[model samples]
Target chain A: MKVAQILKTCTRRAVLAAGLALGSAVSATAEEVFVYNWADYFPPELFDKFTEETGIRVRLDVYQSNEELAAKLQAGGTGYDVIVPGDYMVQQLAQQGLLQEIDFKTLENFPNVEGPLKFPVFDPERLYSAPYLHGSTGISYDSEKVGELEESWSVFFDPDPALSGQIVALDDELEMYKAAAMYLDIDYCTEDPAEATRILELLEAQKPHLLMYSSGGSIERMAAREVPMHHHWANGPFRVREEAPSWRMLFPKEGVNLWADNFAIPVGAQNVEGAKAFINFMLEPENIAAATNFNGYANSIPASRDFIDESVVNDRGIYPGEDIETRYVGNRLCSVEARDLRNRVWTRVRS
Target chain B: MSNRSAHSYLAIGLPLLALAFLFFGPLLAILAASFTERAPNGGIDWSGPVFDAYTALFYTPDLFGELEPNRAFLSAFSRSLYLATCTTLICLVAAIPMAIYISRRSERTKTLLLLLITIPFWANLLARNYAWILILRANGLLDSALQSIWPGFEGTGLLYSETAILIGLVYSFLPFMVLPIFASAERFDWDLVSASRDLGASVSRTYGKVVLPLLTPGILAGSILVFIPSMGNFITPQLLGGGQDFMLGNLIALQFGASRNWAHGAAIAVGLMIGISLVLLCLRRLGPKGPHLSGGA
Candidate 1:
């Protein structure tokens, strides 16, 4: 009886100690800047480095897509310090007044940003959103498997019988829809019902050959030789280079979609000062270059180019020249009607 | 009330209260949302109740008089039902023997076997699904093994197929089916089993007449456990079948995410709930007249 009573007392004390420790830990983390971003979009070590430099610790949450980020914010009271949004999403958020204007004067590295990125159509004034990384959707393939394929988008749309069950397109409604519309020589964002019908018909025709619907994962799949050809993003070659050096990405003769991911402080961000410091830290040349190296995407910091890998710099797929740039089209904020129609069609395609 | 009566009330009342708060409270909220119109950009429309979303579940009723059938919705619903039936059937085939074998084992061996069944649960479901992808992709382990065996055989790996999806569903839900049936098997009257065998009955007749009636409650419980989740599952199909084989879960996810139609999503969710209840009612009607057990997995 005496031993059991003593053991119970010890257990009670241990529980109290643990509860106190957990309470303090929660309070300690409350001082941190909470950054919400895309999954695998940055090296996690960067946050540790930031904490090492600054007194403030950083907390991270990741999301898979911009739609998810938007939905979370729209739901209200997200408690996020900073969020990353793609260009079209930024436009939507800014229009809704869900974003805060960034004070560029506080950041010493603001001038290091490229002139083109500073003038994105979403935030033309560059007040609400800061550019992070940019890339374009195109074709990436295992050269070992695919040989002498056509340079046109038809290679993916109307694929060779040999390439059937080996091709993948982005599962995203807009990206693949744009690719299909561009391949048909129709406007990428046309409102015409006939063009929409044509796009749906095109998607249906291509459905049998596609191995999967995916936004990313093509690089690893290519490395694994699970997929021979992918209607994928330009940044994929850089990612797959180390693992599968034979993998190559190309700009199709048909136009490709250009996209930029940017940083935005939501309206109710609790740690504006910490968020600004974090953003400034990320904009620094070495830090931005580190992000680019880790993610295999192009950073907006122009001065960071000197620190980029030689292969990434040399690859035409990663940094397309003027010829390819002229062919790239960016998406605008889509009307709900058009979005709904496309979703309905996509549902049909998948089902 | 007297202390004995009060204690009995406390025993039942606490669990009922928890059930009401945890399950029915949120279900009611979703039910309310299903009646409201969807806001312009995916939020709830608080203006008023609207039955339009519920009607839209089966028909467009738009400018175009295309009321023949909502092909997308119908296909997704039918596929979900088909997949669920397949998963339940497969689980029944696999779990019945597993449960029986485990029940007949020595206590220590039975514990070990049960532990082995539960071992898969220790690993995360998503991680397990990803591991499946590695084993089943092109030139993956299965393909290579086949290639080595038959030099002329061209190997087609099973990723992004109905077969892969079924494998995932069966592998994940088999344990659920096993546990409940094992409980039922534990209480199985051995004397009756022997008498039926000795009586002029064949093996099949012995099972049908003597064993099956008692196993009905367990079989129903296990089927319910396997079928419901499989019917609404998207992850197994998404990762293993590459989101190519869409199901009810994918359709619901689309309504909430891509389609941005929360009202429609909620309506579909509620509709699925009703469908499940109806299915349970039908099953009960077909069930044998016996002492029904309330064991759930």
Candidate 2:
């Protein structure tokens, strides 16, 4: 009867308000989960399916960047039941006591997780987070324009004369600096000013060739033939493939930064039970496969592979070979000193 | 008298409370945060007051605590000032004739022309900026249109340059300049112009000496409105200028967003506010008094 009452209030409120912008009054007695994740990450119909099956009303909000999500949680009282933070952020949030232990190992679908993803460097014991989607950052270029270039960072760092004013890179400091560091064979988390200066020099040289440094509109911009080469992520090429079949995404010889987004409940979540149920539901092979098919990113659940779209599963951009797998290295949680150096380098590069 | 005083207090008290809560509250918080240090985890460390953030604007501390002269933020600030100044000057030159022309029209025509000026505002600013990209990019609409006229012509590719940013800024803020000058020009007396001409004054002298002095107040107000916002604008530069160079607003955003140095961001904001306030004070002192416009009435 009590469970029924909770479901009744949740569904009734969901019908009235579409389960959005109302998180406070019914929070004490409702079976509702608020999901905050990256933009364009989840299929819209998946939420309805989730609510239908579990009777736990799902409300979704999206954020543009990991820092924004961290900032919101840091400000406190977000009323968010579940948050999707990237790899290093999970460790940071867990260390700051902003995340509660989820004991994901006890979950029924724990066995579905990929072996390597089970003990991620960020959350070794699966204590505070569950792996959601995983991907890597690399170059996505129009082969027709670039004309058979080597699969190396040099294509971006030392752009050809023909490619001048037709290349672009991400505006993010971390991703940009990481790519530079990899190209220069320097440490990504180096606090050394000399090393940072070297990275800055490389970026400054590339700056003139770049049309812009933007993180948004990669797919649309590429589709419109705005740039021949765009520093992009794995999922970007898949989305761009339909529009620009001549374009190709590649991992450079140096390396690429591998990232994993994980689902973790914040400390003061209103409906932890509902949040847990949602996470468990998402862990299902069929459900997460739908997310992969929709967003064109790989999920951590290995069993979901069979359910993935053939175009995505077979795409080299999404699933690179074993030899190139070594190039997908995990990102480091840079020290405060190192982060300061990186920020200064970015400012100088932009200036 | 006591009842009147009580009513006056009630009238002023509510607005004052609202101002304090809405304006001063956040302003004071930012001011306080500017003087604080950054925690290890990228948020403000409110343990104590420090000038590290302000110092960081000019000098970056090395591993040994020695300060290195940093020109990054200084360059961004100067670039923002340069762009804003250019936008204001261009807008002033372009808006004066347009405003004067609008003010001289029939009453209904004047209203219609002003309506036409504001029709662009009905569309979203972001969408308009994106449209500018479509027009300004290489081999884009402009190039295609030009190519139709001259088959061999190639586009210079204006899209991601400072020129494009200037074009976007001037286009966005021109109405701010026009409306204020129009308001002043609408009140101009035609008799002064005829009197100057009757006295055998040259056309240039009559216009320069009579028309310019009366429009100072409107020009000052318009300049302030256009210059201040354009100086701190990040979107136009990010979209049109390709974000290769960081403007003042973009630099502040970098400090807050990726840099995760809220104190530094707050410090830059406070510094920008102070700089703009000083500029406004100078402009006020330089502007003609209300009596300068009395001849118009």
Candidate 3:
């Protein structure tokens, strides 16, 4: 009985010691900056750079889709210090009071930000968000598959029986409906239920021609020659073209949709200063260049363009020409009526 | 003995109660939400009880749009049912011989065979699916082998087809069928078959009348286990069938994911549950009447 008591006392001391050590470790690592960003958006090397410079441990999480990131922030489970939301979502989040207004003076390389990004529609005075990456959504096709370029969206949405099951379109409802609206020359943000019905009709007419609906990875399918043409995001096709030269990213004569992803601090962040520091660090020319090259997406940092290859910086696909720019529409968070119309159209499309 | 029995009941009941509270409570919440209108800002509106979500089910006009014909919840439901039935049939055909072979093995060999059947379960399902892709893709091993054997052979590109999805389903669920069939077959009386044969009964007739009846329990158990999950699976259809082969699970997932329509998703889920329950009821009604027949049979 005495021997057992002695052993139990020793075990108790060990457990207490272990508990104390763990408590101290938790306290020591309490001040951490949590960032949620798009998958492959950041260069892995930057994590090391940020940590080395700031001495503040940065915990990074990744999301595959903008909707997923928004849902996470909206649900209020993730205590993320920083988040990268797309242009329209940034406005939505800011309006919802989910984001903190950013102080521009704190950003040392703020002057180097490009003119296009300086006063974006989402953040007119650059209050809440700083532009990270921008791209366009358009048709991507195999040049070798179809001899001459098909400039119009009608190529994929051809009502002809011959083109049945030869084309693919984006699975995203908003983008798909918007493309239909643009093709029909209607207001992209139409609140009319009739317009939604018309868009649905157009989609249904195009249904027989479509092989499949895909998002994000549609370009890879096109590169593999699984589908002849696809409605794809600009950067995706560009990334694929690096491997498959025959693949071409096209700005449809109808119009292209422009989108930008921006970095912002969430409202209830524990390490707000650390988040600001990380954002500033990312805006550095070399850092942004590395990130842009890694993701194959256009960076909004003008100073970063100087560091990037001239070919990429000047590429009409990445940086649209004036004529192409005139045709492109920056997506904005629609009013409730438009949002309802979008959902209704999307439901009809998916249904 | 009575005290011990009461203690055992308490032990089991307490955990079950806790589990019910934790799991069923949330499920009930979701079910309640499905009956209400969704708020404009993507939340439960909770204004008043309404059947709008259910009415949304018959809104077939949306079917014509960019959405694929087979991607709607109804079509997906039908597809899942068809796929599950096909999977169950395939499992039944494949497992019978394998289970028979396993049951007839020596004690040591039976253990080894059972272990071999279970070894694949150790690997992640995603990894196994990827492995199938590697073997089945156009530039994959099967294509390369075919190309070498016949120089002019053309590729079928079957990896992302319905055939591939069915193959994946059967492969994954085959073991579930096999284990129970093996259990039934191992306990079967070999002397009955011998007696039937000795009485001038043909091998096929004797097996059909004797062995088949005995194996019904295993067959029923295996089919139910395989069919239930296969009917609700999203991953198998997504990875193997690709986007073209949308299933009910995929549609329900989309409602929760991109669509953010939890009420609609819940309504669909409730519909699926009702369908499953009806199927179970039908199965029960058709079950063998005699106590001589096992519960699973």
Q: What does DockQ give for each predicted structure?
A: 0.50, 0.47, 0.27
Positional deviation of A68 in candidate 1, in angstroms? 1.6
lDDT of 3 by residue, A1-351 (tens): 011223334554465446545544755754568888875467666766776677776666666566677677777858899899988888888888888988653588777687566788878888898878888888877777766766787776773455466677777777788889888888877877777778878987787566666663454465566666778877655666666667777887888888888889988888888898888888788888888777677876766877887767666577667787677778788887777667766654654
Model 3, runs deviating above 4 Å: A1-30, A103-108, A159-166, A216-227, A314-316, B1-18, B47-49, B58-71, B289-297
Scored against the true structure, residue B130 in model 1 reaches a CA lDDT of 74
Assess each prediction's global lDDT (C-alpha) against the native. 0.79, 0.84, 0.75
Quality of candidate 3 docking, DockQ: 0.27
List the lowest-lDDT window of 10 residues for candidate 1 chain B.
Answer: B60-69
Order candidates by lDDT, high to low. Answer: 2, 1, 3
**In model 2, which runs have C-alpha deviations exceeding 4 angstroms?**
A1-30, B1-14, B62-65, B290-297
Look at candidate 3 and tell me the lDDT of residue B279. 85
Per-prediction TM-score, chain B alone? 0.90, 0.92, 0.89
- Runs of candidate 1 with Cα error greater than 4 angstroms are A1-32, A48-57, A102-108, B1-18, B61-68, B289-297
Sorted into a CAPRI-style docking class, model 1 comes out as medium
Q: Give the lDDT of residue B261 in candidate 1.
A: 79
Question: Which residue pairs clash in candidate 1?
Answer: none
C-alpha RMSD between model 2 and the true structure: 5.5
Residue-pair clash count for candidate 2: 0
Share of reference contacts found in each model = 0.64, 0.60, 0.26
